[model samples]
Target chain A: MILTNIESVPGLRTVEHMGLVSGSTVRSKHVGRDLMAGLKNIFGGELKGYTELLNEAREEAIARMVKQAEALGANAVVNVRFSTSAVAAGAAELYAYGTAVRVE
Target chain B: MADIIVFIVLVACGYFIGGHRERSHYRSIFAREAATLELTLLSGKAIDPAWQVAQAALVTGVCVISVDYFKSVAAGLRNLVGGRVSAYESLIDRARREALLRMKAQAAALGGKVVVINVRLETSSISGMKADGRSGQVASVEVIAYGTALALA
Candidate 1:
């Protein structure tokens, strides 16, 4: 399913607006690696943990959004957007949402 | 000395029990419910009653869970000599409003007049008890808003 935060997909036209769709998941990873990277910033090093955590959250949220679209019987989801919140000290809520629509 | 120790234990117990109860209450409130409404662009299609029923159930489930948790916590702390429960209220309000706003925006962007039927709300926590003495408390509530938009002929 195609998902973009943009209000309209660049090329595809929305034939039918099938309504709203969304998926979300709460997740967390040890911040130790992030802290280490920050410390290493004295010399400079990649913050692999933070990057990985964000990527995982984004993928999971997107996957869930796709499932919602499928349930709505839409072939694709347009105008997808992603959002995140630190729900707790160690955990984050990642969400992806979009308009489920049929396109030609 | 004994009285002092007893008071300390009681306070600890209050914190432990209070926190545990809060977490479970929020979890129950955040349980997931989904609904779907089908709208046919052509005439002569009947509205799906199942969708309406599902929507009612979802809304009730979420509202009840939220209100119950808030009431219980507030009552629990009422008798205690504490300054304020403002922090908890703020947390709940922020999470709930943010979730609702996100859902509403998504619905509008999809060209649906309003989100009707099959709204899903899920809640989870980030902490787990460990050997290093960390307490598990509710970190966040995730409200998943979903519904079907129909266009009639």
Candidate 2:
């Protein structure tokens, strides 16, 4: 399967537009990670734990989106976009959406 | 008071340590940006038809950066005056640049000369908040950069 954020994939012509597919996931920080983040907050720097957690969540969201595209007989997802929102105090929702297409 | 003393110490530590880290991060960003200058990045949705493309794939980079105690305090003060919060500006700038560089590195891994098109950047604040939402603190900001990378033979 191929994924591209542009309208079409390079060197491949989109044969059919399979409408839109989307996936989302919500994650909350565990206590251990939160404690470490609190300490890191005092000094200001990259939150590696949070970064890795969110990265995994985002990838899972994308995978779910790809699964939907595959179900619709699409070979690729195009014009992909991502959005994130804080659902609760320490929980965040990551959403991935795109247009599924058959490219040849 | 002990609380006041702790606040001062935290602020001092944040100032000295955070400042040093920011400088080093900037140095690294500058050097890596120069090293990856060969990879072209574009926000336009379409690619030039003249170039022969070998492969195309999606590439993404993400960064979660937090503001130090000193900068957050400075920003809070700036908020009262309704002026530009310069303290937070550098944080956002660094996050965006770092995310872009990571995206470039991913594209370079695809082999051959790569041009990333349709680049999109999104920023969101991911800080814990109280149930009532009144105590929502700006602990960190997340920046995500994504695009389609086309490798040319």
lDDT of 2 by residue, B14-66 (tens): 99998888899999999999999999999988778798989999999988888
What's model 2's interface RMSD, roughly to a tenth of an angstrom?
2.2
lDDT digits (tens) for residues A1-104 of candidate 1: 55433344334567888888988988777667534533322222123444345446656877888888898888777556555554665565777777888765
Q: After superposition, which runs of candidate 1 have C-alpha atoms over 4 Å from their true positions?
A: A31-45, B1-153
Q: How good is the docking of model 1, by CAPRI class?
A: incorrect
lDDT of 2 by residue, A1-104 (tens): 89999888889999999999999998767877877777887898898877777788789899999999999999999989999877764566789999999999
**Every prediction: chain A TM-score:** 0.79, 0.95
Best by DockQ: 2
Please report the candidate that would top TM-score against the real structure: 2
